[model samples]
Target: MKKFWLSLLSIIIPASAVTFEDNDTVVLLGNTVIERAQKYGYLETAINLSARKKKLKFRNLGWSGDTVFGHARSYFGPPKEGFDRLKSDLTELKPNVVIVCYGAVAAYDGQKGLTEFLAGYETLLSMIQSSASPREIVIVSPPPAESLGAPMPDMREHNKRLALYSKAVGKLAQKHKLQFADFFTTLGESKGLTDNGLHFTPEGYQTAAPKLVEALGLSVATGNQLQSEHARKLREATVAKNKLFFFRWRPANETYLRLFRKHEQGNNLKELPMFDPLIADAEKQIEALKKTTLSLK
Candidate 1:
């Protein structure tokens, strides 16, 4: 009888492992914005949020400075060992949702032709779909580039061409019945949320994160700060240190530190000049955290 029970338990354990292995995974592929997500802690933030919500596993496969065509070309080159490596990577991961967010580097005229670009993109998507059998695919449009530094002659034309390309991608999404996120429409304005013209600032991600959550059909729990407690504390300390070290604004540092601490403690509403919508969102997030804490008890 004891032997029978042990055998049953062993079978059950492996079956459970198989079940967990079949759980959904989300893959994000893009350029520096997506890569910076992991570097600057936004990916961590997304993971925390997903864990709390019991959503799909999130994976970042962003390659810095890589455009769609560049990545495609790399798959055929000695560097990437070509298409075989890409196939192997995708097969091993077996993601459920694949989010594609490239085109910044491809926006350059010398590197892009609309016909060739579309053909390559289509082939890539078809290959992934057939090989990996992911449940969904999401194509994200690149945001408008800024005009801060000396403007290139092709800058405006590049943006215009990319916009057309985005529209074409959207059409493909419709044809394929895939999910599409028009980030350009959401983040195109000069004053929308970018720090530089191209790369997203923390504030930019803050605005974009919620929209992404909504687009993905994840639960929208308001009031919980997007960042972890440790990150929040570190950010506060860094701000304080910078003020004292670089600017020598001791009095302002004290005030800023006090406000940051107060904000951390969920006791303050006074806005600092540095407090953007992202910080505002963080304050709201604290409220959500408090509620979750109480509920857990």
Candidate 2:
């Protein structure tokens, strides 16, 4: 547990900037913007290159259309059930660093949902602190929605809401003494960044990857590695590992295998952990690919 001391005259201080130490396990959590990164693998590749010499592990737990309340994660259960699932996964992952990005979907609710968004986010931060006790927590604001010309309604008003939510995220980060990454301000509505003015395209993720690395206080000097065939291999391995881990934790047939209907298929529950070695093996391949690239440097 991290300790804090306060003087009668001083305000609460924020934690130091985020850094990826050797052997760190990082968990990326959020909604569509984050979940889509796995498809392109650019974000993780950028981070890996930046931490080339250091052996850092990344587990992306992003759920599409998720919110601070974990609404999207719930299946045949209440929001609390989803919250519990998220808590369990975080505890199991034992991440040294937790990066969270939200507010885009909630921002759609606009001002009426702002209070709930903040409260839910606070609850989430508390759960993360207690569940993982990570050395660092990074709060990332969602990127602004874009307008891709005809058929796409101008999203300037939506961007305003996002800006408001991002501001609140920054304040909350300070209150919790965590690091904040202002992607809303940093990657504001660039042309061709989003496919439908919301989700990022493959090219968009590639462009935004380095920006995310820089925002996390990681170096962008190895950014050129992103263009190499070696980097492609590393990214492919990363995607495979992510697929294995995803099925391990959030299997498509959870209802029959591990939930209320488990009486019929629960016997196969043992198959869940079977992915562990496969995931580990995939990670080893990724590390080997990264090392080969580094040796050439």
Candidate 3:
């Protein structure tokens, strides 16, 4: 009976893998643009849809306030920690598709300054493609951050640079024969979807997720009821687990959010407790699972 129950569980649960052959794994990496999706629960929505549609798995590695070039900078001394961590994170995640969204920070200079930014971005993509061997790579340009009605000094100039950056990325995608999602073009048409000229509202993600799906060519109907049912079950379980985790960490999250908001607004920094221990433990478990999944890919 125990063996029977174990077999039943195996049949019910989708295999934990990140490869294209069994499960579709997508990793979204960027700055605040990607953070907005996490905040608005769009990651959950996309994962559920993928599970329902194609039994796909998804992971997000987006960090707020990250620039295309910022990753190569050091917070303390030499040795770029951010970019190193990014490479490790990608290796651990081993996604089937990598969605790169960035440029808000890179376009801050009031000049046509995408030359260095694009070079760094291309390097990052090359590193990932060579190391991970994902089936597809998707480059999504940054959307227009809101103007915030205060007449930003470099808004127009920055936007222009972003447009050029988008074009460059499109060309790179073509050269690599990879798919590109024109988020900058699509999001520029709508001015109401941004919060403060950078982050996205829930509606923005609602518009963008389907576009991402279409770009990946995974939008076809699988017509598999069993897969749909399994995906629904997995989504429910993941959501329930997330809710519990959120409840447990709500206080810390709220405090962090408040401090994070202040930091983003260019306010003076304040002392905060180190989150490395807790975050590191969670990441270890996640990486272990991700590695097992990568082997499948």
Candidate 4:
């Protein structure tokens, strides 16, 4: 429970100088924080809002309680098997920009696993760079846990350890000359934001999203704030579109998709393909909407 709470607090959504290009397929990979990002659509909306081009694609592939070595995806096997799954997905996505977030769970080991953690991180980075041949790679540092004078368990200690891990991430980014964003250094005064000291409240994600946009490229446009009805609808559409994509990426009742359970419900696999068209429709809507929003600004 301690590790889980502390891990949740270690968010790594980042801002960078590398803005999205027209042809870029931006892929976000990480843990629960990344999964939760899709619900509010703040981060994706901000990235799209800051884009200087049209037809950019965004894919979020974050799973809860994942580790640097793909532990969460292990699925009752060794972590290397999960890493292979990650490799396969990235290869298929062929993303141009891959933004990675990890280090919270690794921090749970404290100083003991820091070295191994970094090594796995480097390995993961190298594997993706080699396989995906991505034009841009960005590493994000996890956000620190905040204590608002509450009787929290060893949060101070957890944060202190996470700080060291974040530093290691920055140093690795520098070595590779990749873009880096340190949410640990950013996200000031997180008290009363994240309930349970880890996961993001919708408001918490809303607060962090623009900062993430700023870290990725240009500052978020004032129009992106939804101060106007058009902006509000556009933003709302973006969220709705993201929700559809989520189903496409992570469908429910996955026990039928593959493995032994397919014998009973394999026929449903054909139904899963239907989501592709829905996802495409949402993407098209976003492209059309982005034009109106851009013109309005």
Q: What is the C-alpha RMSD of each candidate to the true structure, in Å?
A: 18.8, 6.5, 14.3, 4.9
Off by over 4 Å in 3: 1-21, 47-52, 69-79, 110-112, 148-155, 214-297
lDDT of 2: 0.83
**Residue lDDT tens for model 3, 64-111:** 788664454333444466677577667866788787877777777534
* 26-141: candidate 1 lDDT, tens digit per residue: 67777787766644444334333534533344455665776554353242246544345456657867888787876666666433476676676787788778778887777776
Task: Give Cα distance to truth, residue 168, candidate 1, Å.
Answer: 1.3
Against the unseen true structure, what C-alpha lDDT does each candidate score?
0.53, 0.83, 0.55, 0.76
How large an RMSD does model 4 have? 4.9
Model 1: residues with Cα > 4 Å off, grouped in runs: 1-22, 43-52, 70-82, 110-112, 149-157, 190-196, 214-220, 227-297
TM-score for all predictions?
Answer: 0.60, 0.91, 0.62, 0.87
- The deviation in Å at residue 129 for candidate 3 is 1.9
Which pairs in model 3 have colliding backbones? Answer: 145-197, 146-197
Ranking the candidates on TM-score from highest down gives 2, 4, 3, 1
Candidate 4, 1-297: lDDT as tens digits:
456445644654344587567768989899888878877777777778677455788888888899888877756467787898788888988999998989877887989898999899989999899879999998888767756455755477778787788878988888888988876666644565577677788888877877666655566767544345655666677778777767766666666676558888878778766877887788888777766766755
**Candidates, ranked, lDDT:** 2, 4, 3, 1
**Winner by TM-score:** 2
TM-score of 1: 0.60
Per-residue accuracy of model 2 over 1-297 as CA lDDT, tens digit each: 012111211322233447879999999999998888987788888888778678888998899999998879888878788889899999988999999999999999888999999999999999999999999899988887888888988987787788778878888988777898877765754578888998889899988888887767667735356777888888888888888888887898988897899999999999998999998898889899888766654
Worst 10 residues of 1 by lDDT: 11-20
List of clashing residue pairs for candidate 2: none
- Pairs in clash, predicted candidate 1: 75-82, 75-83, 223-284, 223-285, 223-288, 224-285, 225-285
Each model's total of backbone clashes = 7, 0, 2, 6
